[model samples]
Target: MNQKIKRTATKSVTGVLLSIIIFSFSGVHLPVLDSTADSYFKESITKAGVSYGVCRIINATVSVIKESSLEVEPAGIGLSLAIGQIVDPINDMVERLSNVLVMSITSLGVQELVYEISVTLVPSIMAVVLLLLSLLVWLENDRLVKVQNVLINILIIASIARFCLPISSIANQFLQEHFFEDKIVKANAELARGTVDLGQLNDVQLPKYDGIIGTIENGTSYLKQKTIDFKKAIEITIENNGLIIETLLRLTFLYLGIFIIQVLVLPLLIFWFMIKIVNILFTSAALTAV
Candidate 1:
């Protein structure tokens, strides 16, 4: 009894410390994302025959915009470059990239590890406690054990879901807010305004901006069409990124969740195994006394 009490106390203390650490550590990695995107930005903006990296990202982004109207999180800039999955789901390369990148690409990989584990500790320890308590009475009160186990499982699920779901949602929302949401709207509006301005330009004024002049002599049809096309392309780019970022964030969080479940399950299973042994031994001893 004394040993069990000590162990429980230790677990409680550890859980408290861990929860505090996680609370302090879960800052959003938003700022570094622009740095990550800058890697592609330079490539995309440069002259032709420049970096294939820009083309690669642009292609993916364009595709994404064509597919969805949802926003991209700013920090989820990684997702903007991401492509493939939903359109392809299992068969698509995007799905593979999204999953692969979750661990491989984000700063979240190394940094979030400690925090995620920390967040998981309380629920994990609590899970062990519940399981052990359930085990002791499990054989004697089968109905009670079953009910308690179900409740514990629910708590475990709820805890893990709460932990992961928010992280994923935040990542998705972040990308949407920063990169995709207003970007598409702004880009579309600009393209439309550019069209109207070009239309209103007296034939005399079209030659003022070289780029505009070049586009105009090519005629409004060509200029406006290209503008719309390019705008849509950029929009797609933003959309693709959102999806991939969301996926990566989701996958990243799920891994930690699985870890929490394992921690809870393994200890619970061990305790139950021990309980079975104790029940068996007690039954034998009682018979002998009889």
Candidate 2:
């Protein structure tokens, strides 16, 4: 009991010293250190890129899908006409799929929002919380044990908030390097190739028609031929879908990994560390008592 009291007294003194230092620096400046903690600013920016990268990937995938559908629309007309009633349902289903895909793209925006807020504001908030907790601990409040426990918990949270961005970013880089880099690069290259091919398809010039009647006839011919060409262009787009799916799956995994690291894994790690510290203090106190 005497040793426990001494330990508590030591903690109170340490907390008082920290509170003084924090106050000396001013609370506003307190977070600046944490903001840049462990190359956090750079890593945070890099992490932000993941969401942007995913958005770009999804956009490319959508473009390929659009081109494919457009190209197939005209050339597939004969097939559509032959199928008659079946065409309407197929077209409707395709339209619905397109809509759903576009909607899913919004998830990329959600990732951006989440990463930005976490890296930018959360650490600073936690730093301020740490400073406030220090003040409470220093005062050696009536409920000293409760206040110390809360302070320790806040410290764990603050520490995680300080380091999670950089750690998760490193993990992200490792995953990309070891597992997904080549596949993602190839997928990007494929999208670039498809874009180039689309541009080339659009480059073919139409012939001029002489009279109004001739112009009308030529115009109708032009539309049909363009549709057929579009259909051909779209074939490549459809073929790229497999690659797109693979890239999306990989990107989704990266996103989930990032989320788990920041939201769950890091906090648990901090909690584990705090528990170990508490256990060590308790053990020391027990040994001192004996």
Candidate 3:
């Protein structure tokens, strides 16, 4: 009699819980969660856009340097060639960063789409149907127990898949805000400043020679001043080269960090944890049913 009463109480509780699950999935929306997810999605999109813009600026600066005839002759014969060697790798890196940013934006867009679909009537209806079927099987005999377990597992997976991306976005956003935001901002600023300085170097023009008569008239002083100018130009080129390389490295690492966190690491971790939870829930449910 005690066992019977306990079984009755367990069934009653399970029924109530199943009813609540069905109702939650019956086209009901949680405004707060949706709004928060939307906010995070927008913030991610904005950051990606800014990063891509910075990448374009870097590319443009590199292009200007590559196209300019910035030769400091005599003492700086291979100065432009050296700058080119330094910039070529950075150009490749910027191109790769742009591609990654584009992919990040696309992934965010896909996540938003998935979030929208998950909240709509279709998936909600499917979930409601699945819950009802599982509840019915729960009340029935053990003949269809395997089918019931399969349905439960499917529901669990579907639930996880439906909500994982939005939750991952929230997690990613929190990490970026607390950890990477300052570093990203500083790196972007440094890249911008470095690019501007690099572009200015292209404006350093070669001295114009008037004629042989005018050249002979100011020959000694002209040679001395020209040599000084050439040396100064070389120094500026070396300084800018160092600045560009350092900032480029910083920006590259920053971008890699963002990409890994937002796209790869967080999502995989969240999905794995969700799967673990599903396994625990499934095992407990099976044990209770037995």
Candidate 4:
């Protein structure tokens, strides 16, 4: 009778060990798969937002330059001429880069993949099943098994929904820290300087043709025409600067959208689904007891 009892206890211990091994192996893989699958969503959001804002700025500058017509002080003509010469090609480069960044993000199919996997609730469902099956196999006491199963199911669901893919959060933090420090901060300082300098355009003195030249007015008319070109150039430059500010604003909004989706909306939806799963498991267990 003692030997018989020992054998039964040994069988239960073996079953429990087997269940733990299986649970550990399965549990480990779910988080890995989730992180791998969701990485593209994070990457695409960052790239698309930053690139889109840059492109908008370039496009606005090009449009302003093309449409502008005004007169300014004769001394400003050289500055205007230089800007006119360089802006078109720069615009083209920016436009091409923007198109490439956009296409690259779109081609990744992040939203579609995430949507499909989420709709199926594949990972969370698999976790629940694994927990229940493991408990049922390992536990000798029926009442203890039911309680363990419920606890394990809830725990697994919570872990998958809330704690899976902490790498996503880490990556986001890295992006914000590095991008702001290296790119945005310096760009903002330069923009401020440019803004101040542009605002001081009143300091430029127009050429005042003296007596003989003023009376003859041969090249005076030409100088006056050149002054008109200078004004248009100044207008275009100011417009371009405004576009830069607009671009920064747009980029900010894009970042905000990305933050909402990844940090808030996505996680909340996942958590809600997990709660639903827990409730269902509890209800089923209660009915089984009845």
Summed over model 1, clashes come to 22
Task: Please give the RMSD to the true structure for each candidate, in Å.
Answer: 17.8, 7.8, 4.9, 12.6
Worst-scoring 10-residue span by lDDT in model 4: 66-75
User: How would you encode candidate 3's per-residue C-alpha lDDT over 1-290 as one tens digit per residue?
Assistant: 69866775676567556656665765455576666778888887897789789889889888887666454443344655666776787788788778877887888787777777777644564556465563564355685776766666667776776667778877877887898778878867877777776676576554555576866787687677866765675576567667666765676676677777777788789989999987888689889999
Model 3 score (lDDT): 0.71
Please say which candidate is ahead in TM-score: 1 or 3. Answer: 3
For candidate 2, write residues 1-290 as lDDT tens digits.
Answer: 79867775676567566655544543232343333333433443454354445445445544444454445444344432322232233234334433433433343344345445555555455546555664564454578768767766666655554444444445445554676456545644654564444344334322333567866766677867865754564454345444444444454554455445544575457557666776787689889999
- Candidates arranged by lDDT, highest first: 3, 4, 2, 1
Clashes of each: 22, 2, 0, 3
TM-scores for all predictions: 0.25, 0.49, 0.74, 0.41
Name the lDDT value of residue 129 in candidate 1.
Answer: 45
- Candidate 4 residue lDDT tens string, 57-138: 5566455554331233243456645555545554665565565546545643544354445434544554455545544544
On TM-score, the stronger of 2 and 4 is 2
Task: Evaluate residue 76 in candidate 3 and report its C-alpha lDDT on the 0 to 100 scale.
Answer: 45
Q: Which parts of model 4 are misplaced by more than 4 Å?
A: 1-38, 45-154, 162-222, 238-251
Off-target runs (Cα >4 Å) in candidate 2 are: 1-15, 22-189, 198-231
Query: How much is the lDDT of residue 146 in candidate 2?
Result: 81
**Candidate 4: pairs in clash:** 71-228, 71-231, 72-231
Better of 1 and 3 by lDDT: 3
Better of 1 and 4 by lDDT: 4
Question: What lDDT does each candidate get?
Answer: 0.41, 0.49, 0.71, 0.52
